[model samples]
Target: MTSADRLWPFLCPSHPDHDDQSLNPVAADAPSLVNLECSRVLVCVAENDLLKERGWLYYQELGRRGWIGVVEIQETQGEDHGFHLYALGNEKAQDMIKRLAAFFNREMPPLL
Candidate 1:
């Protein structure tokens, strides 16, 4: 297997029925919490990360459904998936860290 396949587990482990072709399947068939609710959502996604795109979508869906008070998306340019871990000392990683800190420090909307 290629490096990407080898690293898939660390990035996002595959589920037992992930191979099934379903658009909006039951929560039990998916890897997400049922009736999940959070006061704030901080999403850090690498711009060049394919895996993170799905996470971005999930957060967007939460925002659309008004389930999250805040949604933050940090797109780290010139970095791939797991850049923070693999691209330590890189400018992109440093920028991502700064953005994360800023997001955490900012005031969030009151929980609904």
Candidate 2:
């Protein structure tokens, strides 16, 4: 199981409204992927993050389901989850920010 799958229960521990499928989109039925409402999607993942697998899974599912939207996954080399938040001065973090800006503005440069 992916780290996100393993941690779903604890995300809202002691709460009555815990939905196991809430944490991982891959947990839902395959056909349900069509229900995701978006014309574009960007999944940013850290190369060394424990949850990176989940990001990949979600990205793959979008393609496997033949969803009618552009989906992209960008992996930041040598970074951990949330590194952009913790190390804003890092070059990789700055690159990620620029990439995100490009994604938001629909100006995604061809992935290098």
Top TM-score model:
2
Tens digits of lDDT, candidate 2, 1-112 = 6565456556767532333355457664333777777678999999998778878988998888767778989998888999999988999999999999988987434422
Name the top lDDT candidate. Answer: 2
Candidate 2, number of clashes: 0
Candidate 2, residue 18: the lDDT equals: 30
Candidate 1 residue-wise lDDT, 6-111, digit = tens: 5545545553323221322223354443345655667777767765655576667765554546566676776677888777698877777887778778876665
Q: What's the alpha carbon RMSD for model 2?
A: 5.1
Q: Which 10 residues in a row give candidate 2 its minimum summed lDDT?
A: 14-23
Q: State the lDDT at 99 in candidate 1.
A: 76
List per-prediction Cα lDDT, in the order shown: 0.60, 0.77
